[model samples]
Target: MPKEREWLTFYDWARTYGNYFYLSILGQPILVLNTHDVVSDLLEKRSGIYSSRPRLVMAGDLVGFDQAIALMPYSERFRQLRRLIQRELNAKALEKYWPLHEQESRELAKNLISHPTEMQSYIRHYAGSVILKVTYGYQTQPKDDPFLLLAEKVMQAFSMASQPGAWLVDLVPWLRYLPSWSPGAGFQSTAKKWSDLHMQVINGPYDWAMRNQGLPALAKPNFVSTVINQTDADLTEEEQSLLLWSSASLFGGGADTTVAALSSFFLAMALYPGVQQRGYTEIQKVVGKDRLPSVSDRKHLPYVECIMYEVLRWNPVTPLGVPHMLVEADVYEGYHIPAKTIIMPNIWAMLHEPSIFPEPHSFLPERFVGNEAAVKEVSVAFGFGRRACPGVAFAESSMFVAIATALSTVIIANARDMQGKDITREVPYKTGTISHPPAFTCSLTPRDGAELLSIRT
Candidate 1:
């Protein structure tokens, strides 16, 4: 297995080993599923045994991520966390957040058009603002929000800590028991610092929400508020802990995913102007220039929606979905899968499968148009089975509005050189757990008929 950008290597290996292949490292068996059918067969058809998560000693147990929903093992606590989140984030419950999503996404378009050079920073701010508001009723500062910075720090640490083979403790669990001063024990000190930050992120926002819950001017009906209000006024230690960790899970999972998807969308538009033009045309036809495009206009804007799907397919946010551990030994298609085998679903490979999506690497939204199979299959990009991200509805809503709003407001085109020639596509993507389009300059010229008043929040 490669040290970094494992997804690319996994895709290459899939060509030789076919859909499903296995490897054992230091007696630890790993199963890499490279196609949708295989992932669905095991992760969905046999979800009972495929939903458990692998224990990452360095990232999970050491850095204090084990309590977060994404890395928590399959157990009662995990179920409780899922239930707490699903109650507020489900499609029906998410109706309350539409206004919040639209408000922030509109602000995003306004900020991007005003400060076109800081596209990536504005995108981060937009995502951080949305998730922070949804998870806790706290509003972000216009610039350099402390909560946003803390979340960024936590996510950066997680990306490095959770990466496969990045930390030896994950492979050799015994190393975690070593003292910080011992030789080869430097990770202990790092984990200690990250663990402190993790606690703050998990506790800081939730505490503020609680303290302000009773203040009329400060209180807003949000996930933390709603969860707290529904429960007993004086909660048990377990219940409060559950609420804190679960609510924190929302920001941890939702923010980065939103940033990655929107980043990829901008990159795609820069690379493929024709598709971007088509999307802009669809937006103008469906939603007149009198106002910005809202998430509600999604159905009317089919081409725009296709562009969103294609962006996801072209460069998935989580290229390799979080590893799931087999619950017990089982047989599948004449293969004996031992218990505890780490299941890595190569989502990038599935999205790029030639048979499922022809010209898989090409940026083509038309593939999803009038094609139910292709559309349904792409759902794997979110994840699969019991472990699939519960924020699907929320994710899609935020992404669609952001994409639609941007299309209505600006034209995303490549930057020009000193001689005025279009700078050709060179940088592709940054590889990690969540893949983002490498930084590239894009001109965000305001679209004709789109006025400053239309994007005002």
Candidate 2:
């Protein structure tokens, strides 16, 4: 299958092949876990053996070896990095940063009201700024700052490197031994460029903050500062690099994924105005126009909550999800999974399963609002087991505040062409590791004049 249609193509195959299916990509076993039960069995129940990441030959050899938390084996270094992430991005830590999230989300709403033409860019900036501010104690003011630009370049390179046929080195490990002047040398050189760019982005702000301790008090303490202040005497340079890599991982993972989900949310709103209206009504009833919806008001906004859940389920950011690897040889239902076999929990298949989600193709937030069981089960969008997104709390809170505030304040209308018909319906996604709606126009008029004036200030 072509990369663009990989998810839908795999879904079709999974329907025909049952839950357990395997395909060889360049002589490497690629196991797809199609059902919730199977994914849970391996990723959640047997996490100790299933959480290791499959080695990307090009990435591992060219990039810093064993210096990437996401790609590292399940060793002590991995454990330490994971522990730091869990502490920094956990529920309590997310709550601690709620004020900053709220402030940035409000700024996002104001930006939309002022420059609706830059809606997509603002979304990217908002997500990136929030993560950067929280993770590095630095806020990205100019959207095209050098650090942000380098981050984008790194993402583009990473995406290219991640493509199925991007590098033959992945398939033929022996080719990695070729000299720098070889055809595959570009991949290594690009990887080095990415590493250098990322190191500068990660360490520059940190070094500055270390020199001027307690100088500027932002809304909250950033993750980098917190990590630096933490007492980890045994942290090696390799471990520190891995920690920095994990922070970069958050920007890479959290920024694009959240923006994609929110973009999907807007698309859903345009397609189903009633769902959007219902969410608005619920929020209005609970928290009147006197104040915007805050984290404290989330529980009272069930309809909005359901909408958020549906957005994730409708089109997950990582449709294939981060592939999990087997640490030790294992067998499931009489099928032997060799050690180091690449395991992928096909979240696309699980979320779109007919038995689990009725009319899975449709945009129906009510399924979650009507059925409690579905909400509990739909958590697979984040992934399963130990390797699940550590920033779930932070991501969820950011999305909620952004979505609820946007719904409550703006009148998100579909853009019409010269013929006066919706143009967004005709837009399609450009292919990548993450799916994003192709750029389409939208109007963000404030619901009322007062709301508009408030945003102006």
Candidate 3:
């Protein structure tokens, strides 16, 4: 458990210690599973006893996020709550929401063409608007949306609180229960500030839906409204509260992670021109210039699909999954394991394993395209077993359509400086549980006469 931003240093330790290792941090035991096979065997095969989450005192309870589906303790109620999210986000259900995705994705291409310099803002807006509309039926403002800012602020606080040893109170559970005035409890103040904003995200949309329930013609159907309409009499207060939190996790889980990966997609396009050109050619031949790409085009454009996989493989957003807590003790390879130990999957190490992926360091989609059989496994980056992200189908659809449309309509190039030389320097990604490509100058130009339609459409 490193306190500093050098958490990836554990990757070096993985090289020396082999895939699996156990250690004790401040008297708390931790099991680090690094290889894909071991993670599948332990976390996937033995999910019954490994699906619980380690109690995050500061980030969860104190910040009013304990109710969040991702942070909730392993319980039947939480499982049911997550199932609700899965029902709405599964591939079949997501098709009904394609109008939302198609409209925003088209806006994404137009936004890139209109504001080439602010790729970060438009990328975030594209992802956020999709989730915002689907989950809350709320339309997003073009820039400086209040809801987007609050969500980012709340999400930022959670990210800060999740560092290995940033908050001592999280390590010492008793410290979290102390009064607000207690010394060394500044985290409580910080948590309150974020939770206040969190309340708006949690209740604002739900309450709006409740007030507009009867007027079907005036109402904009969304996830919150759908859940409310189907279960008003059957749902207990606790169940309703669970639904609210699970739905709000869309912004935290869906928007941030999706936006981060899409940003990496842009970086990859800039760095690997040949791969980008091939992907562009594939999109051109399949979809042509009459219209922008759509979700239906994904199956025909396998190379573009490979680019999405390679982007995720190259830079996983959550390298170390939300830690899993053990519910029972078991021995693996004759080693003694104890119950209640925290299980941490080193996803970065597994995805970068050279034996599984030749030239793993390179950004090559051909590795996945050439051998489809080897890649036929569940995604570990989103998570594994029962605790896997419920939004995988929805997320992949969002990335696929956006990438396809962008490739068909734009050319991602290196920015040029005053001397006419490309400013091709790259910055290191910020260190965190959720990582993103650092801000860099990149030139985005429309492709041919077809892009003129993109601008007007």
Q: Best candidate per TM-score, number? A: 1
Decoy 2 TM-score against native: 0.90
Q: Is candidate 1 or candidate 2 better by lDDT?
A: 1
lDDT of 3: 0.78
Candidate 3 lDDT trough over 10 residues, lowest sum: 418-427
- Tens-place lDDT per residue, model 3, 164-200, is 4567776788987788898887788888887788788
Stretches of candidate 1 above 4 Å error? 216-219, 415-427, 452-455
Q: What residue runs in model 2 are displaced by over 4 Å at the alpha carbon?
A: 64-66, 163-166, 183-186, 217-219, 229-246, 415-428, 449-457
Q: What lDDT, from 0 to 1, does candidate 1 have? A: 0.85
The 10-residue segment with the lowest total lDDT in model 2: 448-457
Looking at candidate 1, the ten consecutive residues that score lowest on lDDT are 418-427
Which pairs in model 3 have colliding backbones?
none
lDDT for each candidate structure: 0.85, 0.74, 0.78
lDDT of 2 by residue, 276-369 (tens): 8899899889988778888768888988988999888887777777678888899888988888788877777788888878999788888887
- Sort every candidate by TM-score, greatest first: 1, 3, 2
TM-score head-to-head 2 vs 3, winner: 3
